[model samples]
Target: MHLFRGPGFVAGFSDRADGSLDFSDRTPEEAGRLWAGLPAVAGLGLPPPRFAHQVHSTTLLRVGADAPAGRQGQADALMTSVPAMPIGVFTADCLPVLVVAGEAVMAVHAGWKGTRQDITGRSIAALAEATGVSPARMQVFMGPCIGSCCLELGEEVVEEFRATDPGSLACFARGARWHLDLRGLNVIQCLERGVARAAIRHVNDCTKCLSDRYFSYRQMRGRHGTQFSFIARLPEEGAPSSGAA
Candidate 1:
C-alpha cells in the first residue's frame, strides 16, 4: 500500500505484494475491485472506489454518488470533488496518475494511446474548472509504471505520438525499436500545459524491471494483472490512522 498524503486527501497506488493491499487479480478490473474492498483502504474513509472501463481513449468522467452509481463506466480518467467517493485507475504497464487540487481529486489512466490523447492535461483542466487550483497549486503523483528503460515502441505507435504530441519526439531513444520515455513525455505535457515542475512527483519504479514488485504486461507478453491507483478527500470526521505501519 504505497501512499501519498497531500493537503486534504490520501492518495496512492496498491503495490504487488501478496497481502491485504495486493490489488492484482486475474484481470485489471477485478484487481481494482479487490483493492477497493480492502479494510485498510476502507479506513481511509470511502466506499469501494469507482473504476473506469478504460479503452485508452481521451474520455474523462466526473464521478461520485450524484454522477454515477456502478463500476461500469467507460473512460480513461475520472475526477470528483465529493468526499468519501473514491476514484481510481487500473494499470500494469500504463501510467496511473492521482491529482489533488483544492477539493477536486482525480485518477487518470494513460498508456501510449491515452497519452497521445493528452488525458493528463485534460484532467488538470477538469480540476481547474471545479476550483481555482492551477497546476502549480496542485499535487500530482505518477504511479509506478513501465519506464523509459523498457518502453520500446513500434513505428505505428511512434507515428501516432508524433502526430498527437510533437513534443513526444523528444522522449525517445533509437534502438532495434524506439525506446520511448512515456513518463517523461507526460511530465513534459503537464509542464507545457501549466503544471509546476516541483508539484509533480513520479514513483519512478519500472514495472517491467521490478518483476517481483509489480505486474508488467510487456514483460508477461500481455498476460498480467494490474494495480489500482486512487485519490480522494480524506473524511474529516474520523480519519484513519496513517504512517509507516
Candidate 2:
C-alpha cells in the first residue's frame, strides 16, 4: 500500500501487496478482512470504510458527522468532515482523487464517464459549500491510474473531451491513435475549481505499465482485482498530521 499525507489528513492507495481485496471478486465481508490486513490500515482505530457500486456515474455522497457505517450509499464520490470516517474508492486504472480541507476529506473515483462529467471540478465546489472552506484551501492528491502512454483511445474519446472543454484538447494527443491524459484532465479541473497549483499532487504512475506493483484491470485482462484508495479526517488535537497514514 502507498500513503499520501496531503496537509491535514491521511490518504492511502493499496497495491497488489494488499492481496485480492477487490470487492468484485470476494463477498463484502471477505473483502473487509483483506483490506484490514494492510499495515497502514491495521489498528489505527479507523472508522468503518464505505464504498459504492461504482457505476462510473457522477453522483457524489457526503457523510455526516454521526455517520459511522459511512452511509452505504451509491455514489462515485464520498466526502466527510467527520473525524475518523474513512471514505474510499476502489480502482485499478481509473483515477482515485482525494481532496482535503481543514476539517473535510473527499474520495473520488473518476473514470472516463465520470471524468467527462467533470466530477473533480464539481467535488471541489460541493465540498467547499458543505464545509464552508475556500477551494484554494483544499489540497488534492491524485493516485495511480493509466497514464497517457498506456491510455490509448478512439477518436471519439478525443472528440468527447474537446466538445466538453475545448481547451482540454491540449491534453489529448494524436499519435498512431489518440491518448487521453486523465491525470492532466483532473488537474485542470482542480485548477478551474480554484484549487492552487501547489495544492495538487499526483502519484503519477501508470497502472497498466506498472502492473507488478499495482493492480491494472486492463493489464489483468479484465480481471476483477482492484486496489483501494482512501482518505480520512483525523481529530483536531494530537493527530499524527501527515505522511502515508
Candidate 3:
C-alpha cells in the first residue's frame, strides 16, 4: 500500500497479501513475467520498477529515464529523478527505506550490514549532493522489518555496530540476548545526516510479529518470501523540478 503521497511523488510498501515480489530465485524470463503481473505495477500503469541485486552492501545506483525496466546492477539502493519512473527494493525482514526530495526519489534496502555501513545516511548524502537539496528537505519512510523485540543479534554483530558508530550503542539492549533496534539506529543515522525528525515516518510493524501480514526470514527459518517497497516521481505538468539530474 502507498505509505506517502505528495504532489510530485508516491511511495508504497507491499505486504504478504500483495503476493511475493521477490524475483531473485527465479529465472530472468520468469521474473519478468511475474513482475509484469503485479497489481501494484499494472494498476498504477507504471513500467516494471527499477531495482538491483542487493548484496547487503552500501552501494547505490542511479537510474535515469532510459534505464532498463528490471534489475539495474549490484547495489543496495536505487535513486532517480526521472518523473514517472519507479525505483524499489525487496525485503523479507530487512528494512526498506523510501526517500523523497523535491522531484527526486530513492528506494533503499538496509539490512544489518547496510545499516552498519550507514547506507541510509550515505544515500541521503548522495541524494542531497546530486539534487542540490538539503537533507532537511528530504522525507523518509521506513517499512516493516524485524523489530528489537525479536531481532536477537550476536555479540560480534553488536561490536560491528559499535565500531561504526559508538553512539549507536543506545540502539541495543542487553537481556537473554542482544536485541538490536535496527530501525532506531537507521533513524539516528538519518538524523545525523540532517533529516528532520518530523519528516520521517515508519510503519512500526514487526515482520516477525506479524508473520501473517508480512514475510519474516528469521521466523520462517531463513526460508521466506519477500515484499516490494517502491517510490516514484510522478509526471505532473506543473510540478516543480528542483532536484538535480
Strongest candidate by lDDT: 3
In model 3, state the lDDT of residue 81.
81
Please write out the lDDT profile of model 3 over residues 1-245, one tens digit for every residue: 54577777778998987788887667657766776786666665566678899999999899987886777889999999887778899998899999998878999999988998999999999999999999999999999999999999999999988887899899999999999899999999999999999999999999999999998999999766898899988756485643433
- Please identify which of the two predictions, 2 or 3, would achieve the higher TM-score against the true structure: 3
Q: Rate the local accuracy (lDDT) of all candidates.
A: 0.77, 0.81, 0.87
What is the alpha-carbon lDDT for the whole of candidate 1? 0.77
Give the winner by TM-score.
3
Better of 1 and 3 by lDDT: 3
Ranking according to lDDT, highest score first: 3, 2, 1
Q: Lowest lDDT 10-mer window, candidate 3?
A: 236-245
- Global Cα RMSD, each model: 4.6, 3.5, 2.8
Q: Identify the superior model by TM-score, candidate 1 or candidate 3.
A: 3
